[model samples]
Target: MTSHKRKTGRRRAVIGGLSALGITGAAVVTATLLAPAGAASAVAAWPQAKGSKPVPASIEFSGTYDGKLQRHYGTGALGSDGQDESQKPLFVLKDGAVLKNVVIGAPAADGVHCLGSCTLQNVWWENVGEDAATFKGTSASSVYAVHGGGAKSASDKVFQFNGAGKLVVNKFQVSDFGKLVRSCGNCKKQYPRTIVINDVDITAPGTSIVGVNANYGDTASLRNVRVHGDPKKKIKPCVRFTGNNTGKEPKEIGTGPDGTTCRYSAGDLSYD
Candidate 1:
C-alpha cells in the first residue's frame, strides 16, 4: 500500500490508520474542542479536521465483537446512547485489534476495552458516559493522538489502567475530565505494570492530572506533559504515587503558574 500526503495550505494534514499496515508518516489527528458545558478550558493549538485515508475493510461496527483472532474498528457507529452505541466497547478484544478513524458521539460506560493488546490512533470521543479507555487483566496497549472530552454521564477519568503489563500513551489531548490518567490500586507484583505517558496536553481544572490513590508496584514515567487551567485551582502533584512503590520515582517537566508541580516523587511531590 502506498501512502499519499495531502498538503492543505498551512494546516497540517492527518493521514489515516492504514499506516499500521506498513506505511508510515501518513496517519494524523486534528484537535477538537470539548463540550460547552464549562467542562474544560479552551485550547487553540490545532484545527479540528485533517485529511486522511479510508479505513480497512477488515474492520466492522457491531455492538458486540470478540477479537479472538484479529480485527479492526473504523466506522461511524450503531444504535443510540445506552442502546448499543458505537462509542461503547461492547466488542471484546482478547487477542489484538486496531481502531482508527472512530468518532464516538454518544456516551457509554466504557469506550474501548483491551483485554489483550491493541493499538488506537486518531480516535475521538465527544460526550463520554464513562472512561474513554480501560486496560485491565494483564493487557498491553498503545494509543496515539486520542482527542475527546465531555463526561456528561459521569465525571469519569479519561484513561484508566487497572492492571496491565505495559501501557504507552502519546500525544493524548484531553479537553477536560475529572482526571487524565489513573493507575489502579491492588497492583500485582507478578504483573509489575509500567506506564509511560509522553506529550500529554490537558485543559482540566480543579482536578489532578493523575488521580491520587494507592498506585502500587507500577512504574510510571511522564515526560513533556503540559496542563493548562487555573493554577490556583489546579490539582497539585500532577502525578501521584502511593503504596508499596518499588519502582523509580516518576519524572516530569514544567509546572502550573501556582507552583503546581508534576509528580509525587518522594522529594518532588509538592512545590508551594
Candidate 2:
C-alpha cells in the first residue's frame, strides 16, 4: 500500500452534485451530491487492490449481510497491479466496507456500502485509479439502488442503517466519463421513501447524469456540486441542484460555488 504518513502533513487531500422530476417516494426519480462526515483526523489511502486475472464470473447479489458485516459482492474490473479501473469501478460493498477517505475503484454492483445506520455531515468522490466510482457519504441506512452512470453493471449502493432509511447528500460528482454515458447516471432507493440526494453533478457522455429511462426522485437538501473538478478536466455545467424532489424541501444547508472542483484529484471533497 502507498501510505503517505503526514507528520504534521503540510496539507491533506479533499474532494468534493443533482436533479429532479416525478413525485414518487420511489427515488424512482432523483439525484445526489455528497459531503464528508464521521471521518478520522487522518484519511488513509489504500493502494488499488489487484484485479481479477481473466475477469471473474458475473457474481449474483444475494441480499444485505447480517446486521452490518456484509453479504455478497462482486469484484470490479481492476488493473493488474490491483488498482481501481480508472475508467470503470470496483465492487467493494460485499468484498469489504470502506470508511472515510478510503479510495475505491468502483462501488458495489448495487450501490455504495454503509453497513450500519449512522449520521453523516459531509464526504467526497475522487478518480485517482484507472477508472472507478469514488464514495461520498450519503446516509445511515439500507443499501441504495445504484445505477450505471455510464458503464456496465454500475448499479449498486451501500447503506448504514435499517428501517426506512434516509440519505442526505450535499455534493456529488463524476469525472472522465465522456464515452461511457456522461456522468454517474443513476443513484436511487429500491424501496419507496428511502434515500435521496440533496445536491449533485450529473456528468457522463449524454451530457447529464440520470438516464432518460430512470425515475430516482430524490427529496433531500442540496448545494453546489460539479461533474468535473478542474479546468484541465473541464466539461460543462460543473455544478447541479436536486432539491427535495419529493416536494417536501428536505433538511439541508449550503456550500455554493465551491470553485475548487478543478483540483485534478488532489483535493478532499467536502459534503460536511
Candidate 3:
C-alpha cells in the first residue's frame, strides 16, 4: 500500500478526552507528579477509550490514522493472545505512518507493527498479547517513536525491536510486564540498536526496563525514570546480553549501567 506524508503547518489533533485539558501529547498529564529523587518528572493517567472496535485482519495504515481513543481488539483470524510467534498485528504501519489516540484491547495479538519508520502517539495497551509493538525498519537511520501512552499486563515484552534503527519512548507508563524494550536477541541478522527512554513510569511486578545486546553494540539511554511499588529495587534498570544469530536463547552477561551499553546515572532513576 502507498504511504503518505503528514502535511506541514497542520495543527496537531487533540487526543480525544484529553483535548479539553489541553493535553496535546500521547498521554494525559495529571497534576499529581512523581518526584524523581533528583530528576524532574511528571506522571500520566491512562486515557479511557471512547469506544471499541474489533479487527479481523491487519489494517494497513499510512499517513495518519486517528483512533479518537477507541479500543481496537483482534477477532477471527487475528484473535488469540497466546505466546505464538506468528501472530498478526491489529495494525501494520508503513514508513512515515502515524497511529495516534488508539487503545488496543485484549486478544491484541501482536498489537501493532511498524514496517518502517513510524510514530505511535498516545497509543495504549490494556492487555498486551504476544507483544505490544514490533519495530521492523531495516534502515539504520529509521526511527520508531512511541510518545505518551501506557501499557499494562504485557506478559513478555512491550516493545520488540527486531529490525535496525533507533527507538525513542517518552512519557510512557508500564506495569506487570517482563521487559519494556528488547533488542532482537537471536534474529538471523542483527544490527546495533539504540534506545532512548525518558519521563517514563514503571510499576512493580516487572522484570527489567530495557534489555540490549552488548555484543551487538546496542545502547540504551534512560532518564527521569520513576519506579513505583518495588522498594527493594528488584526491577533491573538495564540488562546486557551476548546475543547471537542462532535461534538459541541469548546468554545474559550482566545488568545495570555500564556507562557504555546502559547509559544512565543514579540520578536518572528514582523509586517511590
Candidate 4:
C-alpha cells in the first residue's frame, strides 16, 4: 500500500502540470511520463484501497466525484457479480461528468455506465463484473476518456463500447481479462465508433487489446502498448470483426494492424 501511494504520488505530480490541458491533453502527455528516467523496467503495481464501501444502489452524479481511493463493492440487490447481462451499474455518469480516484472491489456489479461524454481518471477495478465500464453516449461528438487506471479478473471485456463517437483509453493497465475494449457487436442502434488506446500496460492471460467492427466502420488506433509475460506474443494488439445488429454473436474476421480499421505499427508495440 505504501508503494502504491508512492507511485500515485509520482503520477499526481505529473498530473498537476497536465490537468489544466484537460482530459485529452493529460492523456496524450501522461503516456510519455509513465516511463520515467531509470524506471523503464518497472511494472505498474496494483493499488491497495484505503478502505471499503458497499453500495446498495447505483450512485448517479454529474460534474466530478472522487472516491479517495476507497474500495467500493456492491451489496443487496447489486451484490451479484455474475455474467448476467442485465446487471445494474454501481456508478452512472451524466454527460461531461468526471469520476476519479475510485477503486471498485469484488461483486462490482456492472462497474460504471457513462451516459454521455465523460472522464474516468484513476479508477481501478479489482474484479470486473459485467464490465469495468460501459460507454453509452449516442452522439458523434461524445468522447469517453479513461486515464490512469487498471482492471483485473474480467471474464470478458473490461470496457464495452455500445455508443458512438470516440473512446480514449490512456495510461491504463489490465491483467487476466478478456478483451480490453470491444466495440458493440450486436447493438440495435449501431454507429461508427472510434477508439484510441495509448500507453497501456497489458498483462498476459488476456485476450485482444482492441476489438472493432470493421463492418460498422469502427477504427482503433493503438500506440505505445506494452505487453508483459507473453513471450509467445499470443495477446493480439487489434482484432477486426464483421459485426451486426441482429442480436447474434459477431464474427471475427481478422487480427493485427491493417492500416485501415486497425491502426498502428510494430514500433508502437513493445513486449516486456
Highest TM-score scorer: 4
lDDT against the true structure, per candidate, is 0.44, 0.28, 0.85, 0.88
Q: Is candidate 2 or candidate 4 better by lDDT?
A: 4
lDDT of 2 at 117: 34
Residues 1-272, candidate 2: write the lDDT tens digits.
13445411211222211223111232222221112322222222223333322222332123332212122223444232223323233333432232232223333322233333322212222232222333333343333333212122222212222223343333333433432111122334322223333234434332322211112222222233343334443333222233333434223222222333211122332322
Descending-lDDT candidate ranking = 4, 3, 1, 2
- Least well predicted 10-residue stretch by lDDT in candidate 3: 6-15
Q: Write the per-residue lDDT of candidate 3 for residues 1-272, one digit (tens) a residue.
A: 12223321112221232233223343333212322223355567778789899999999978999999999999999999877998999999999899999999988998899999998888999999999999999999888888779999988999999999889886789999999999989999999999988778999899999999999999999977899999999999999999999988999999999999999999888889
Better of 3 and 4 by TM-score: 4
Rank candidates by TM-score, best first: 4, 3, 1, 2
Could you tally the backbone clashes for each prediction?
3, 85, 0, 0
Q: Where is model 2 more than 4 Å wrong at Cα? A: 1-98, 105-112, 115-164, 178-190, 199-207, 210-222, 225-272
Please state every model's RMSD to the true fold in angstroms. 11.4, 14.1, 9.1, 6.0
* Candidate that would win on lDDT: 4
Taking all chains together, each candidate's TM-score versus the true structure is: 0.53, 0.29, 0.86, 0.89
* Clashing residue pairs in candidate 3 (N, C-alpha, C atoms within 3 angstroms): none
Candidate 1: which stretches are off by over 4 Å? 1-91, 137-154, 186-191, 212-215, 237-272
Across 1-272, the per-residue lDDT of candidate 1 in tens digits comes to 12222233112211222122121332223321122111233333432434322222223232323232221223344223342223445333443455555554443335666655555555555555456676654543332222222222226576677655656555556655666666653334324455555445556443656632323344555544556664564554355445333444333333332222232232322122
Off-target runs (Cα >4 Å) in candidate 3 are 1-42
| Candidate 4 lDDT, 1-272, residue by residue in tens | 99989877777655553343234465645554656412344557878899998999999999999999999999998998878999999999999999999999989999999999999999999999989999999999999999888999999999999999989887789999999999999999999999988667899999899999999899998866889999999999999999999999999999989999999999888897
